[model samples]
Target chain A: MFPKMDALGMAGAVPRAPQQERSRVTRARLLEATVECLVEQGWSGTTTTLVATRAGVSRGAQLHHYPTKAALVMAAVAHLADRRATEIRAEAQALPTGPDRLDRVVDMLAAAFTGPLFVAALEVWVAARTDAELRGALVPLEARVGREMHRLTAELLGADERRPGVREAVQATLDLLRGLGVANLLTDDSARRATLLAAWKQQLKGIVNS
Target chain B: MFPKMDALGMAGAVPRAPQQERSRVTRARLLEATVECLVEQGWSGTTTTLVATRAGVSRGAQLHHYPTKAALVMAAVAHLADRRATEIRAEAQALPTGPDRLDRVVDMLAAAFTGPLFVAALEVWVAARTDAELRGALVPLEARVGREMHRLTAELLGADERRPGVREAVQATLDLLRGLGVANLLTDDSARRATLLAAWKQQLKGIVNS
Candidate 1:
């Protein structure tokens, strides 16, 4: 049980180690639940209560950490970005310097756009467009995610990213992959996605090798 | 003044022509208003009463045509598709059949993605992900729009429609442009968009010319 804030409300209060650990665990659970709700139910169905229920945390605890739903979702977005950055690095380190690595890297980029991570982020992006308070929180977080993704993308491509205009071309490729991800939302057409991926991989080779 | 439905609600009731035309005009206005609202206010701010007022139609008239907001928005998606199809044809004809044509065509495609049409559609798409009835109405309309856009894109490019990989390449270009459009929503960075366009144009030339 949390004591009254007045007990710990001093200007420079320091919580005990056990309390800090409990708070961290509760926050992580809430963020993960938010992602789950977004992917399965989208923005309209994702609420603070639902997130708290799914995380098995009391509403009081949820509100204590994130007073507003926007705060909770914004924190979740930051959490997702951190996970994606770690993912990109892991994928890059796992890949070798050869044609097979290129194929694998391209696949990695494709998955990043179309997989659960992108879907979860997309729900927030859509909701933010209409919600002013959310947009205020999301814009800075989005920029950081974009920068992290760009760096990881370059690392994945290795020497291919060094040439002039290569960055632009690769950026375009990622953008298109995202578009394809959106398209897939309604149609679920794997064949077209595959065809586009093959064509883009070839295009990337031309841009980088040139 | 319209009478209650029970008065003329028999199994096979016939509405007169002038009334039908008036209804048509009212529906068109409402659809157009929905797009304007989406671009300016996004989904959260859009509602039936606001659309009816914006369209200058009576609330009764609005309810008579589309009983639910989902129905109204779904119809708007179809309306948007028709407008895009018309825009593509007009742009293709306005463009000359030469080198400059390719440049203009690419620019036109880029605008189609980043312009009001795409943004309006995006609002509906985002809203639909969480709304089942809306999703059911949206999927078919989206497919029809996708097909119409593809045909016009082939014509705009002035190329054979039967090529093996050409469709994939062109689709990828459109998709990438759309992704750029989404990115622009937050950052509003025209310079980055232009650079991506130039890079994508080169990539397309390689894909199609091959």
Candidate 2:
């Protein structure tokens, strides 16, 4: 990205827009690699060195992009949240209008909860609780993520705008999915997941019908 | 606990059953301290030195009881699980056989999910996922806890044991509650919790009636 002087040594300094684009691509690759490491190795093992190696970039290039580990990890999470928001938006747009919409929404939401992104985020969230610097950076980002998630969930559910608790219930749905995701970390337990999904579907059907 | 001697302290030279009582008390105190440490300061800040100080025991005495940090944390979690089992049994015994029972049970379960014990256990669970030594010790203990938890949840719900999916749905209730608990870690959103509770109560009522 930076003329490849660091690692990967491709060429010298390039032009403005193209250089920036390459930089963006490199940054995205590093962040994606960070998430992969978090999911596979958890917090303790997700080192900057590991991330650089995973990203297929030189250590110097990684350092040039992210000056610190906390910065790299935080940026990675924010990057992930943004990507998820875009995915949700696209999914919501393409979703068919029908009785089965809620089921599809739940499936999408469940996938969002139980995957590598969620695991990576969970690792950061837990670590940041005790780390003052990390917490300071994460608090605002998590708030933004929460708001977007709540809004998307509300949209997917077609929840009543006039209802006082509809939004809160949507938030609860996300919270419940998060809990199920946490449970899945230890074991896949599909029967438990299916039962939970059925119960969630039943309650949502009640809400929609009401 | 061995008499503060021998780092590899594996010998019958310690003492008899009389020693057992004192050792039990020391071990219990250490475990209690560990939970406190976990709740107050997550995994990273919880050190053996700090735990030994908090438990009002000598470092050597702590080492004598549990040789390693992994062992200490695992034992603390197992101890908490056992204590929770006892509490659940007592709660089950005192529970009334009436229409309000499910409501009361939900309240009790909610308290269980959002408390110091659950937080302590969650810290261990998250840490264990990354730590091989910790995970090896934790898996079996977590299985035992899961069994006890499932058993108690079934008792509280008065779920029919013969129904395959019903019991799993009950487990889902617990999982959802746990997710709510995790959300509460960042913000105490009582309104959302209440809405979820109401929804869950309605669903449970439907189940009971059916």
Looking at every candidate separately, what fraction of the true A–B Cα contacts under 8 Å does it contain?
0.61, 0.52
Residues A1-210 of candidate 2: C-alpha lDDT, one tens digit per residue: 344543222245455597887797799899999999998888878899999999998899999999888999999999888888777778777989889888888889998898889999989988886678888898888888888888778877888746754654576678789998888777676676877787677766676547
Winner by TM-score: 1
TM of each candidate vs. truth: 0.88, 0.84
Q: Candidate 2 docking: what grade?
A: acceptable
Worst 10 residues of 1 chain A by lDDT: A4-13
Q: Write model 1 residue lDDT over A115-185, tens digit each, in one string.
A: 77788888788778767888888998898888778777766776466677888977876787778778766
Locate the minimum summed-lDDT window of 10 residues in model 2 chain A: A1-10
Q: Native contacts recovered by candidate 2, as a share?
A: 0.52
Error of 2 at B80 (Å): 0.5
DockQ of 2: 0.42
Best by DockQ: 1
lDDT tens digits by residue: candidate 2, B70-172: 8889889888877776676678779888888888888788888888888888888788877878877888788888888888888777888576457646776
